[model samples]
Target: MNSLEKQVESAWKNVDQQKDTLISEHSHHLQNSVDEELRTLLQSVRQLLDDDGQQLEKDVDKLQLIAQQFREGVEMWQQKAQSSVKAIEEKQRVLSLLVEDVSVRTEGRRESLIQRQQQRVADTEDNCFRVLQGISS
Candidate 1:
């Protein structure tokens, strides 16, 4: 080949090499962009999962606290009920003693009244007998 043909062939080869290099670089850049976008999306998903997990933990803690409070309330109410029952039993015992005392006093009063009535009847009978004897004599 002549010198001009050689130069022309060399120029064409150079142009072809530049075209191939540009296409390869563009493909690499597009792949990098897609990879970066996928990475960003994955990071967002991870953040959301972390937030949800934290919220779930907080909710579990709140539920546990409420359960503890409920248990305490039930125990306190049971104690109150026991104390109330004890108070009522004491009152019942006191009332029983009062009733017994009242019954004894009433029985004593009835006996004394009966004795007085008998003595009065005897005195009236003696007076009547004396008056009848005097009249006869």
Candidate 2:
């Protein structure tokens, strides 16, 4: 009976050791899985950051194109404005010349009209004197 009891104790100790070994292996496997998940999360974050950088670069390129277009448009507008200003200055010069010419012509016409009125008055006086002389005769 003593030998049978010793055999049973030995068997129980072996079973306990197996159980401890299995628990330790399970804990190691769980830690490895957690490490793998953390690594995957870090990689995804890095990829996201890289993608953001690429998108920002593209945006900057688009803004540069827009700025170039705006500059060209402004340059064109300035050219057109300068041309319009030149045209307006020429028109003003022509208008001033026309006004001067018309003023000179108008003054000449007024002087001619005054000279014709003085001649008409002299002819009327001469006719009146002739009538008076014929009556005296």
Candidate 3:
């Protein structure tokens, strides 16, 4: 080859090497950017999962507390009902005793009234007999 052709060939080789180097550098930068983006995406997904899991746990705890409160309220109501029933039974027993006492007192008063009336009737009969005898004589 002549000198001019040799110089042109050497220039072409230099341009090819520079092109390859630029391509390799661009590929490396692209790979690093993709890796960084993937890491960010994975971290975001993990955070979301953790937040959802914690919220689920809180909801479950609230449900359990509500259930326990419901159970305690029911138990308290049952206890109140039992106490009311016992009080009512006691009142009923007292009322029954009062009725019996009143009945006995009323019976005693009736017997006393009857005895007094019988005594009055006997005295009237004796007076009438004495008056008839005196008139006949």
Runs in model 3 lying further than 4 Å from the true structure: 1-52
Backbone clashes in candidate 2 total: 0
| Predicted candidate 3, C-alpha RMSD | 45.5
Between which residue pairs do clashes occur in model 3? none
Residue lDDT tens for model 1, 12-72:
5675587557656765675576557556755665566566887766655665566567556
Q: lDDT tens digits, residues 27-92, model 2?
A: 567557655765675566556656688676665566556656755675576567557755765675
Distance from true location, Cα of 106 in model 2, Å: 0.9
Give the Å error, residue 37, model 1: 47
Write down the lDDT that model 3 would get. Answer: 0.68
CA shift of 52, model 2, Å: 2.2
* Global lDDT of model 1: 0.68
Residue-level lDDT for 46 in candidate 1: 56
- TM per candidate: 0.57, 0.55, 0.59
Error of 2 at 48 (Å): 14
Query: What lDDT would each prediction earn against the true structure?
Result: 0.68, 0.66, 0.68
Pick by TM-score: 2 or 3, better one: 3
Candidate 3 lDDT over 1-137, as tens digits, reads 64545665575567558755765676567557655765675566556756688776665566556656755675576567557755765675577557667867998999999999999999999999999999999
Worst 10-residue lDDT window, candidate 2: 1-10
